[model samples]
Target: MSFPSFLSHRLSLVQEQQLELAVLAEHVKRGSGHMRRLALECLAQRQAELAADLAQVAQLAAPRAALRKEVAA
Candidate 1:
């Protein structure tokens, strides 16, 4: 083939490969975004459960404070 045709052929191949790469990259980005959102939701739920447990512990300790003070005196 002529030099011009050869260059055009090569450019076309390169363009095809680049398009495929762009599609793959987009899919990866979408998957990563979805996974990150899922992880964040799980973490938020766990944090809320931990907060509730801590609050319950605090409430139970409140009534014991008077006994502690009497013992200290």
Candidate 2:
């Protein structure tokens, strides 16, 4: 084969490889975006649960404050 034909064949092979790489990159980006969204949702749910627990703790402590004040007087 001539040098020109050899280079042309190699160029076509490189192009095909580049196309495959682009497709793989896109797939990874989409998967990462989906995972990020799921993580954020899980974080929000955990925050809500913590807030509820804090509120319950505060409610339980309220009655104790009055009793302590009465004892101090």
Candidate 3:
């Protein structure tokens, strides 16, 4: 599933997550031109611990997102 969709599945508050997802979506929408793409890539390739970690970054940047991007950075 898509990243945002994945988040939506896990999070209860769809509206709030949507807002944050919208913004992050914009960050990712730039066709790999945006610097934040690095963050997205990190999310994509990472497994287990590192993957969860990057996911947390995205969650934190937005409003009440889920999985609370782990802080062990």
Q: Please provide, for model 3 over 12-70, each residue's C-alpha lDDT reduced to its tens digit, 9 standing for 90 to 100.
A: 44444555555655666664655777646643443344445456656654753333554
Two-way lDDT contest, 2 vs 3, winner: 2
> lDDT of model 3 at residue 54?
50
- Top model number, TM-score: 2
- TM-score-based ranking: 2, 1, 3
Candidate 1 residues lying further than 4 Å off, grouped into runs, are 1-31
lDDT of 2 by residue, 12-61 (tens): 65556555545555555565677756655655565565556556545655
Once model 3 is optimally superposed onto the true structure by TM-score, how far is the C-alpha of residue 42 displaced, in angstroms?
Answer: 8.0
State in Å the error of residue 34, model 3: 6.7
Record all residue pairs in model 1 with backbone atoms less than 3 Å apart, i.e. clashing: none
Greater TM-score among 1 and 2 belongs to 2
Error of 2 at 5 (Å): 83
Predicted candidate 1 versus true structure: per-residue lDDT over 1-73, tens digit per residue = 9744755565565556555545555555566677756655655565565556556545655667767899999
Scored by lDDT, model 2 comes in at: 0.59
